[model samples]
Target: MEEKIKDVLDAYTFQTTRVCRGRGAFICDTDQGMKIVKAYHRSPQRLEFEQLVKYTIRDRGYYYVDQLLPNKEGQYLNNNKDGQMYTVRDWFEGRECDVKNAADVLAAVRQLAVLHMLMRRCDLSEDRVEQFSFQDTRQIFLKRRKELRAIYSYIRQKKQWNDFEKLYMQLYSDCMQEADAALSELNQFDFDGLRKKALDERTLCHGDFNYHQVILNRKYTAVVNFDKMHYDIQVKDLYQFLRKVLEKNNWDSSLGTMIMDTYLSVRTLSEEERRVLYAMLTFPEKFWKISNRYYNSRKSWISSVNYDKLCRFKKTEGQRQDFLNIFKYAFIF
Candidate 1:
């Protein structure tokens, strides 16, 4: 850890005596102030891309985020040493919104709506904007299903598992199969057809909007992590936000419906958008599969932890079935 920090800021003075460690980086509280130092194991591409996205969002009139500072060479805190990519950002002092009430949820949605409006009107060039095309999302789902099947097969063949372990293995198998069937139907969807529908209904999307990504201060909402920002179906973002809310509450379908209704009141969805909502419903699962693959691979610490949390979250078969039932009812209508 010391070696990594030195690689980025060799001569930088330290002010504080405390350092906090996270999965990806270290938070140093020194005399120089609070700085978040993130080190990537191999690829700097993602780190560099995230810095650029942060800059773009900040420059485009969103004042909620702390600005990314450049180094002496005018580079955005991206320095590679010993095959590791290191970067730093000024740490802002704030707490995550507990979001305990409907008002908190509604306020967050309103901020997201405002963000979508800004993203739609910004005259940014195509290269500057990053979007997840429908095809790309579908491929992610396919890859995930393959990986989950492999894990389930391995567990089944081991033949030494306990009853709970066996039950979970079967549960995951059934869930993946059900998700695959839903995604298979979604894959047949024509992007060209969706694009036409989108032109009439499209809006700028946060690509990965949810409670975790949103930081609320006393007066304003600050959205971080623009790496997933794209020009895909706007409902994709809304669907993810709702899904997170439901998942956090142990698959409370009533809460999900209330949140969706509140959002719809502010930004009405067209009939065509309603049809595409089914496709959007499956997108989160697509991401879930990607996460599962990373976990199953057991390559990185962060991925492993995420995968464990995901498995734990989806442990209850009855809860997952309830979610699916609600999903089918909401979108298949």
Candidate 2:
């Protein structure tokens, strides 16, 4: 560990018995327990907000959160001599939730429902309330849809094209159709009212909840990385987790059913939440993501990884459609 890190750890109350390198930080086995020390890049207020949400979850008896620990001076964030900020939080002795493993995935889903149940209506300061509120998704979707058209126009005018560009051009029409369908479906609902209701309830989403942040250990299934938590439709969290796991499993409807059933067992979804999830699934998120990355990057030398992702997305279209059909029939109807 760097001497600066040691200096920072010394500020904490725990006595560091040993230290080792972790994923992106230092793993220090201290007197209190296993703690992770990493350079914090966000503002101190953001860290304070994250800490507040985690503490709220813990206070409600969900102690599996990786909360930031305060230093000797009673501050969650501390600056080193060089003006670098560091934060130490509780770490777990476990592996990431395996999306392919049915048991692990189900457990994670159930825990997510429980977390959502507890994460609602956190008291935010008046100033931070507007800052942390959900943005207008309607305008956001229109912007992305417009950008998709722009990308198509840009690729079409190119004098020469690579394999990725050729494939993107081939798939552009179908991708736009899906995007239109998602927007159409979204327009059918009281999206504005849904946002208002969620805000009134003070629902908070894990924001970046996925298998990577879910830790599976013997004692508990721990959820980490709350840096992106914000006020929004909580089902947005469920939709994201389901899309990721289903994509990895070739969009298996059986697995999808199990996930939905598992979550429903803990907490039921309102009709609007269910519809919102289907609309979110209908969006060509993977296509948009690949295209967005391609458009933003230096295109003179395109990467094969992009081509591979495009190919995989193309190959899985049929299975994805089938799963969406089943989901709509079984859940959304």
Candidate 3:
């Protein structure tokens, strides 16, 4: 596999004596600094769209994103063996953001604010916008609710319950109660209107803004892996980043406030936007994940440890609620 990919790399005009695998891609030390290569199946049109987005971002004076390198043919994509398409980008010399670090968490929040503003300025055509616009928050919530109901009964019917199942049914019974309240709170507003506003803003979110996507260079922070970049409410990135960090921090209120304040300093969160953000934060995403994975798994038996780990969310329920209560009034009251 390395040799084949190396052959593809050789096609590039750059001379490369060595090729080695790193993480999900290859890291090649080239005359033009170090470059990272990744191969995946993507539509030519999508690649073209990505190129324009990259150019706009770079042109707008935001140069932190990884630069995509064209192949020897002067094209952004290379069709190699197995019909795999490959593209290389300058490797970023930085460390992934440590969510546990308050400084790193706050820095990423500030970066997200700046990115949201920059993405709002990108001018994409109607056709290009239509291709990747996934405004399905309502449908997603509805689907999760359905899954929860099914999973609830599936667990209840088990004759002999394991410790994990018994605990899941116990604590998650309260966790299950949250779903209705959150949804009811959500139903009080015109969510569609907020969605339309987000669409009109033409905002782009990192889509996946976890710790790995955050890169901390000497004095600069860079974000990578834009494969899922899409147009939506700018706050989507904030909500996504905050949820992950809050979980890691055991929903520490002070840390969350500092992170939120950092972002608010850059991008003022309006009342309506705050409401939307609150809705996103309150949704039981982890609940859906546990249910979906358990229901989907076909293995006759599973590790008790794994099931126990899943039940650990129960212990953290207080922390999650406390986290939400800290900012609930920003939207609710």
Candidate 4:
């Protein structure tokens, strides 16, 4: 960790040092500070993509993000070193956005709208920024299904497996089959036409837009985490926000409607986009598959966490169906 900090500060020569870990490595000062250092233990490609996103947002005069620190080489990130990709940015103190308040929720919608608009203007091809299309999402689901099923089979064969474990294995299999069917239907849909329509109609999108990514200061809301930023359907981001709100609270249809209404008021969605929203609801299932693969591989700690959350949410099947019903209302499926 100390070595990672040195790599991050190699460009700035900062005096203070503190580290906090979340999705990636973050270095800050012990006291109130002005700068932040973020390092990823992944490939340089990811860091480069993040830097590109930061540059794009900053160039458009969006102050929601911390400014990328430039080295003497005039690069915002250091890629010369192997196994360490790091960049520094100006730090802003803030808190997470409030979800209960209607005004706060509307504000988040507006912010997402602006973000989507900005992403629409970006030159994604130059940065090798690939959009997560329906095809890619389907492929991920299929891959995850295969992996999870293998894990379940292994668990079932184990001598020490209990009744609860066996029940969960059956549940996992059932969910995987459901996801597979949904993905197959999604793959057969007119995704090409949908993609062209979405691109031509909608603005830029923060692919992983959610309340957690939005930080609230006294009077302004700032968005962070551009790592997953991409050019895709605007509803993709909108649905992500809606899903979180449903997950956090009971399935609140009014809240979901208000968010959609606010976003559409800012940036209108086409009939085709509305039709594609149901297909998009299945996108989160891809992430579940990815998470399951990671858990099975022992590569991520999220499997246990996500499983617990899903179990808690599963207690209210009607609520789950109600939330899903929102997507059905949007799409023909």
Report the number of the highest-TM-score candidate. Answer: 2
Per-residue CA lDDT of model 3 for 237-329, tens digit only, reads: 888899889878778888888888899888887776787677777787776777577677763765575475576666677888887888885
- Cα lDDT tens digits for candidate 1, 71-164: 6666654655665556666664555545566667777777776666555434444443433334344565677677666766666687486443
lDDT of each model, Cα atoms only? Answer: 0.59, 0.88, 0.77, 0.63
Better of 1 and 2 by lDDT: 2
Q: Rank the candidates by lDDT, best first.
A: 2, 3, 4, 1
Task: Kindly provide the TM-score of model 1 when superposed on the true structure, using C-alpha atoms.
Answer: 0.66
Best model per lDDT: 2
Task: Give the C-alpha miss distance for residue 120 in model 3, angstroms.
Answer: 0.6
- Cα-based TM-score, every candidate: 0.66, 0.97, 0.93, 0.73
Model 1 lDDT, full chain set: 0.59
RMSD of each: 5.9, 1.3, 2.0, 5.1
Return the TM-score for candidate 2, rounded to 2 decimals: 0.97
Query: Could you tell me how far off, in angstroms, the CA of residue 223 lies in candidate 1 after the best superposition?
Result: 1.3
List clash counts for every candidate, in order: 4, 0, 0, 3
- 2 or 3, greater by lDDT: 2
Clashes of 3: 0
Off by over 4 Å in 3: 330-333
- Sorted on TM-score, best first, the list reads 2, 3, 4, 1
